[model samples]
Target: MTVVTKPKAQPRAFISLRSSVDFVVTSTTSEIIDRALGYLRAGFPVHFRGPAGTGKTTLALHIAAQLDRPVMLMVGDEQLTSSDLVGEQNGYRYRRVVDRYIHSVVKYEEDAVQNWVDNRLTTACREGFTLVYDEFTRSRPEANNVLLAALEERVLVLPTSNGANAYVKVHPDFRAIFTSNPQEYAGVHDAPDALSDRLVTMDLDYYDRPTEISITASNSGLDLAEVERVVDIVREFRDSGEYDQAPTLRACIMIARVSALQGIRPSLGDKRFVQICLDVLESKTAYTSKNRDRRTAQRKMLVQMIDHHMAHPLDAERV
Candidate 1:
């Protein structure tokens, strides 16, 4: 009997494989980090569910950074094709092989495989890159059927000369992370139960006070006192049924950013600050009429809220 040995496989070319340890995970967003870490450890895909502007995409990016894998992101669209997720056979080229008009010339031509294949999902699977399918459910589910097998069986069926082909087995380190709005929201789909079952689902809502304040102050460059005051007003307004739609952390951050950009302090006395808050509330409430009147009346009430804040800056009481 004779024994034979095969050569070791070479590593695939990755975009970049370096992990960054610095990421801010406020209490409001800590669950995102925990869920991502859990999936990374358990070898499962994670589905982050939230309303728009809830930091789903940011959370996914933070996870990719922590895992030290290069991130590949694809925003789902209605016209997305399987070839868009995988690669396609670009057309071939032709050359004149010979010139026979005078019967005195000979020439040679050659055909070869295209040197490169577009590697969206393929590269991620092969090189263990972190893939973030942002707002994946926005696209029709039919467009993503091919992913079912690739995600479950860890096999990518690529097109080749012989019809369809299979590439290197999915690397053990590969991970899939998805973010999407809830199905009830506009432009989102109820993911097939089969696919949903395979993923670890985490429903994310608005951020809590401490976390919201921390994020606003740190990211928006607002003073801590001002951040707290803004968070209080937004949280109270949402809880008090003053608006049909709840204020998202995104809205708060936006308000803070706008205030900073305008060189305005977080003082409630600034009419412009009140107007900014009103604008955010209006945009968030446009989808529902349940509290339309209440939202409309909030403008009048904001002046009082600002006056109270100014008069009793040290009240230390929640609105």
Candidate 2:
């Protein structure tokens, strides 16, 4: 007779997310984050709901970091499923044993069994890791049905085939953060009311002008005055409702950074600077009408916007 010991399997590495160091935390941003943290620490999951460029996903990661736990990040997809959330039987694990009763004779036995793997959600629940599910509504609602009980009952019901461990007791330190675009946005699916009832949703809008300018200045390596000029034009364009898509703070930063790198000032006096502003802002509308000259009209409007903010040399003196 022979005896053997199974070696221990090493634990898999937990997922790591890069720090949100570049995330500009202004007064308004701080307030939103604090409120979301309050909800999360109180044993309720937090949801940041807003349109595109509203920083929902970024805010979710920021809040998850404050929980002081290892984080698991999940990007929602249309192909996700309940098994994808919990555990599923994968290929198989095989074992072989050889017995030598006498010097002249030997016998062999082999066994194989299905391997089960825990997906991100299940691992987060069992190990008490913070979960950041970005663009969760992009996943089909049926795929997310597994979350209902986990959020409400503090228990995760697993498939019976998982055998003795058919359910996971939600860890006391477990927390989940979710982000999603508005239901009207393309490729965004409507979340179920049952799941929505479990979350404390915070609807985010674009940062106010002061915050936008501050963020642009920090990210673009541009002076406050220059950033203000760029942000002002973008904000004006956003408010005018003259385009297919609204311009965002991202647009402001894009213009500011490129101009700064190229040694172009944000001034109407410089033709290159004027062209940069038009190029960054004009792409939003993309007019292709042969009948009417929408491009000419919008170009005229955008130039007027730039002239309002950057044409004045005195604006620099005030800054």
Candidate 3:
């Protein structure tokens, strides 16, 4: 029952989606974006659920930015607690005074008080800031209980016993968006049913090839053809059903960015380029079949894919 206080975080860390400015809105992703925005505008909390690298967190931030309110971001993890969310008495402040002047003067005074610090949730709720709770499922359900009332009743009950108001009225402008991967993923807990019921959950998968190509090209500053080649190579492995978790757009960006920066072409003949792709991608391939050696099979597949793409460079215009 002890309150644990962590240092105050910069307000911008929770709400600012600075990277969202460059987020691509292509034909494939537009519908998802529009739907999420619609739900948020309707005063409903939107939850973007998907696999890692699907850009769930990014999309959540984009939606939060669309609200045009001060932003607050809260990361969820196993050790998170209600105190962590709603704020706690950070510590105490003390002061002592001594008086000595007159011939017989002798006086002393002392004062001590708990220092109350508002957490991200409390500050955002009170100020009506848009909150993006990323990877919320990583936090235990009990830790997130504080959000039930905030989401349902628009009130936040403070957990301190320092004799202050027990609850806060949520600001009318307050809105929240949450992002998480599937429950099957490791280290993620099931969301409380009651809390889940209050949200409009949207499932996000990998972006279509063109959308991904655009994202990679824009973010990595690589030639469109090079980006497309990498994207195609990744897509082949992903769709081949060889891995439980496919490399995502993030992998494409990494490969593209490194290649562009290092002046390494995305080709099988280039040892560094091949190594970069394998390092960034090979571990994600599940390689679960008992029939073959996973490590060897995975390496071979990657090498062949790279060689194929290199020999037959994608037609940038057609792509």
Candidate 4:
């Protein structure tokens, strides 16, 4: 994470979608996108399930944007509740009236009522905004129970709400995209069977080699050839299954982007580049001071692995 002459301002590591020209589209991603879009068009809520760093959230956002609708983004949390997704009555609204027509008698009336405010889910269902619920499994399953009817019956049931607002008919244009990391279990809950049945789930994994190279190059502003080196080393390290946490394409972008900013090449001959690789990838291990020996051993292996990959060029093939 260290750089020689640190960037004074935030680095533009990524060139975001400015137009169709800047959009990162490849045959691999296009197929996935078209498939997800098709399910969505068929009136099914699409779920992107995967392990961490698989681009689930990014792909969800891209698909949502393609729908040409205003998007509502909500991140699931351990403390999230149904009221957090839908609306809830918090404060009270009060009104008072005094009778002036009766000269002989005075009358006064007062009433207090609870106020209901729409939350992200309620608003999206009511206004037809596309909802991208990221990492939804992190929220308690009970909290997400509200989505069952919203996704299935095309209505949001407000059991606690009273009056004509008891239920909201979901807008025709309303759509939902959910992303979750199944490998995360500490705070994440299992997807409810009912909820899972309602969604068109798409399990995802790392993209092919060319897609990774294109994404890294596009995001880091590094040329494809240099980006390929960083990707190859990291991908090989991941496949080795030696690290506690596997390095994803994100790791590749970090090395390439930072090296480019510092005018360093992604070559083992450059000490700075090698350090950057270790700094980016080695810490992904589970080693701590309790096992400094293991940490050092992994560090040496990472360096040797980098040298090996840099020395032997991998053929341009799907990995």
Candidate 5:
């Protein structure tokens, strides 16, 4: 008799092509991969905190993809309810009815099933999918109270229409990942200590120079020289402390793309390109009359950066 053997499953690629399409812009870094692996191995909920435009959402999505799990995403808001995280019961519907006439009063009872629980957390737990809660702390801390037990004990105590006695248990394979800006940013809430203790927070910083330039070049369709120039300019501004808020690689890519679209070339004489950098810095920093001198110094530094870029084209290649 001949026996058939099952084929072994091949390992998934580190970076899937489908996952790449999810984020049009991303700053690739080894730290991101390390954090993803840490979460996967530790079996703990992971939280990503960073400044705005630092690709926290993109990183979360990429990590979810790397885990090779179905992703259920929730964008937190102030109006979010427990039902939004757990589940709610809609009105009951009667599918079958039988009537028998008798001398006594007819007996009737309603039958119901608590089967429809729809929410990111509930569905992820029930289906053993990866849950991405973006800007989770933006909502009231009370809204996430339903998640405490689910995240800690791997069991979701859901509310059902039957009564307080009804609840749904979470599946064992579920995992959660969260991403949010720093609490100092507007519209962010301080994460409750209870929830914070349950998660491993990975504070993400801006991408290092080479990675930033590569990401900007790949996404912006700009030459490496142009990408490096933009990176250098931003890095100088950040290191010099001329601008209170440093422009992110994302901002640099935007400026490059806009410059290219406007027929601006990579040259020091490009006033429009310089203006783009100024606009990014001005919009990101809180302007005040007291910092007028600082602003002027920043503009001078920006001009010097442009001149340096034009004078030494080979310097842009190093990044």
Candidate 6:
């Protein structure tokens, strides 16, 4: 007998979209959207702070598109440097010439020169693009110090050695959107007070249950019933206080998408589907009891919850 094995799929390369983010605006988020647009239009930088998977970055991109300007997205990280935000002098080019003036005489001349490369922030400031600096707090505050002048004084100081080209006036149309998670979250830095004072800061929490259902159903291409079941289970886990990381709508979307792709019904009796949910969500929940093994306790709790929910599903209105 011959056996066949399926090949693993390769990861896709990063591609920036020219079009605006396709977002479904339910009644819950409509007001927030309008308010955010109002702040951006009134010439103030807008900042969105929220937990992971709350769609802060998505909303920022959508708002940027509303401005009818080109979009530039920059993700922050620990290694992000000031030179990365502004322009940097990269390497050098050399020109050399040799001339033979006479039979025994020769002259040689060489010149080396460096050229500046504009990074996302500088280019956005110069060309009036809507800059979305997502998760800006992940980067050290010093790396973002350049923004103080740009946001307030409408100017960006260049790192040029020559005094003549020290700064550029920020284009009148240039706008910025910043996003970050709460400080208690991992890999976050306390934003400088001066910089925070300049932005129109807004807080975002997870969408209401109904909105989450809508978002999960729309994004995952799953039936509403199945998506609801998945969402309910994840929400229960989140509220249980058993996990360090609450399973967000992002986790719901992942489970829904995989199940839809494989035609697996969301059921506790189905070992395969149960395993999928546990694998995607089990590690996120933390154990608070000192005597219990975290991994084992979490696994038992999730299994029991899945079984209970499957047998007696929550009422439609409750979730």
Give the total clashing residue pairs for model 3.
4
Compared with the true structure, the alpha-carbon lDDT of candidate 1 equals 0.71
Better of 1 and 3 by lDDT: 3
Kindly report which residue stretches of model 2 are placed more than 4 angstroms away from their true locations once superposed: 1-21, 102-108, 286-292, 314-319
Model 6 Cα lDDT, one tens digit per residue, 33-92: 799889888889999999998989888877787788877789999999998899788766
lDDT for each of the candidates?
A: 0.71, 0.86, 0.84, 0.84, 0.73, 0.84
All candidates: TM-score: 0.80, 0.91, 0.85, 0.88, 0.80, 0.83
Model 4: which ten-residue window has the lowest total lDDT? 10-19
In candidate 6, position 275 carries an lDDT of: 90
lDDT of 2 by residue, 1-319 (tens): 6545474573755766556445688899999999999999999999999877777887788778778898989899898888878868877777777889886888878787777788888999999999888999999999898999999898998875755778899999999999998898778899999999999999999999999998888878888888888998999999999988889888998899999999888776789988988888888885676725887889999999999987676555557
Model 1 steric clash total:
0
Model 6 scores a C-alpha lDDT of 0.84
Q: Report the number of the highest-TM-score candidate.
A: 2
Best by lDDT: 2
TM-score of candidate 2 to 2 decimals: 0.91
**Model 3, position 47: C-alpha lDDT score:** 97
Alpha-carbon RMSD, each predicted model: 7.5, 2.5, 5.5, 10.8, 9.1, 10.4
Question: Across residues 111-227, which tens digit of lDDT does each residue of candidate 1 receive?
Answer: 444433556777787777878888888778876776777778987766565443545477778888888888787778778787888888888877678877877777777777877
Model 3 Cα displacement at 3 (Å)? 31
Which whole-number lDDT from 0 to 100 does residue 39 have in model 1?
A: 76
Q: Would you give me the overall lDDT of model 5?
A: 0.73
Clashes of 5: 0
Worst 10 residues of 6 by lDDT: 6-15
Give per-residue lDDT, candidate 2, residue 290.
77
User: Which candidate model has the greater lDDT, 2 or 5?
Assistant: 2
